[model samples]
Target: MEPTGSERGPARYEPGEGCVTTVVRVPVRIVVLVLVVPVRLVWDVLTAAGRVVNRTALRPLGRGLAWLWQTLIVRPLVWLWHTLVVAPLRWLWRTLVVAPAAWLWRWVLVPAGRGFGAAVVWLVRYLVVVPAQWLRTYVLAPLGRGLAWLARGLGAVLGALVRWIVVVPAVALWRWVLAPAGRALAAVVTVLVRETGAALGHCWRAAGIISRALGRCLAAVLRWTLVEPVRWVYRTVLTPVGHVIRDGLWRPVRQALRTARETVRQTRREIRRALFGAPREPEPARAVVPRREPGGSGTRTLGKTSGRDVPPPARG
Candidate 1:
């Protein structure tokens, strides 16, 4: 048995079997990979070595360059900006712009406005308010009072003129024309009546028989017309009614008024006593004055029995 196919495998060797060498055929790309793997590994190792050298050796050499850039170049530029540019600009703005404006407002504008306001106030007081007050007090008030007085005088004069011209004339006209004429007519009627009465009296005396009858008839008519009813009403109605009111109604009212008056007086006295402690007692009557004797200089007092003048009873 020449080496079977299974024995051709490297791990598949049998006992007493002949050694068989087998060749595996590979592609060109795999063969090239076989050839390039060691070179690629060596290249990677060389790059790693370069990175270590750069970390240890080259990074330290560049640090001085970075320190020089920050110290010498950047610090000087920042210092110049702060000292030369920023500080001067800030000072210029404060000194030239803000300070001048504030100074002008504080010193010039504020004082000018204050003075202008004071001037306006002064002008208003002297020109407007003072003049107005002066005019009202000194001129207008006096003028108004004078005008009122003149108007009052004019009204009084007008009233007097109207009274004298119109009222007096009307009263005179009534007195002169109407009143005297009325009086004259009334006197003429009175004279005519008296003359007629005298003529009737003479006729009555002359026709004595007829006069007696007519006189009796006229007197009876006059009594009936004017006197009898009046007398009867007075005696039977008015007098009795008056007596009844006086006795029944008016007497009680008068009595009640008297009682009320007494009550009021009593109440008043009680109130007066309550408020003022007590009513004062009336003063004693004064003594009568002694008469002066004729031809005597002093007064003489009358005595009880003697009828002689007593030396003016010792003055109380």
Candidate 2:
């Protein structure tokens, strides 16, 4: 039968039945998944392990970058501290040593310089100045004063000697000349007086002798010639004729006698008038001095002539 299609199909196991022989043949897709899943798991695990290995390989490079950053930023701060702070401490050490050395020189050395200057000044005064002053005062001044005193004394002595020697001799010579002249004048006066007295005495003696001789001669001549002749003539001739002549010529003779008397009287009067100026009128005649005899000295002696008295001669 090909059977009826349904029933005749292979023995016909019933739906429930047949040895239940289900020949479950899973599908091809399930089969393929089950096979491919383990392979996929293994691939994923291997890729994860490869990524971790790559990260580990880059770690050294990152560490090198961090170290370079720290070096650039921090090294300048440390170098600045050493320069500003540490160098100043070294300079301070040198300054401290030099300051102490300069102070020692100022305190110890200045006084020694002043002492040296004072010693030089003392040595110059003792060596030069003191000896010069002593020589001027003690030796030179005393010698000059002594020479001046000697010159003054010598001038005074010379002046006194000149006055005594010259003046005394001149006074003695004047007295010697005047005394001889006075004696000569006195002798001349005495001679002149003696000569005058001798001349007067000679004249008086000669005049007296001549007057006496003249008087005696005149008397003798008159008596002899005139008186004798007149007496003889009168006696002889004139006596007789006297009477006759007297009578005749008596008148004429008498007249003549009268005339003669008159003439004589007139002549006497004229003579008196001539000698003593005019005569006075006639009165009684006064007596004159009496005359001495002719032989005696006439009238009066020469000594008695008072109106002719001689005066004495004048003396020098």
Model 2's TM-score against the true structure: 0.19
What is the model-wide C-alpha lDDT for candidate 1? 0.73
lDDT of 1 by residue, 64-152 (tens): 78899999999999999999999999999998999899999999999999999999999999999988998999999999999999999
Which window of 10 residues has the lowest lDDT sum in candidate 2?
1-10
Candidate 1 residue runs with Cα over 4 Å from true position: 1-206, 280-316
Best by lDDT: 1
- Writing each residue's lDDT as its tens digit, candidate 2 over 1-316 gives 1223322212332466222123211232244345444544454456667677656765666677677766775566567766776667666755776576666667765676678778877876776667767776898788778877887788778766765666555555545754566555554444334333332333223232333344456666665677666666677767767977878899888999999999999999899889888956789888897855744533356456433354666799
**Can you list the residue pairs that collide in candidate 2?**
none
Scored by Cα lDDT, where does model 2 land? 0.58
Candidate 2 steric clashes: 0
Give RMSD (Å) of candidate 2 vs. truth: 99.9
Clashes (N, CA, C under 3 Å) per candidate: 0, 0
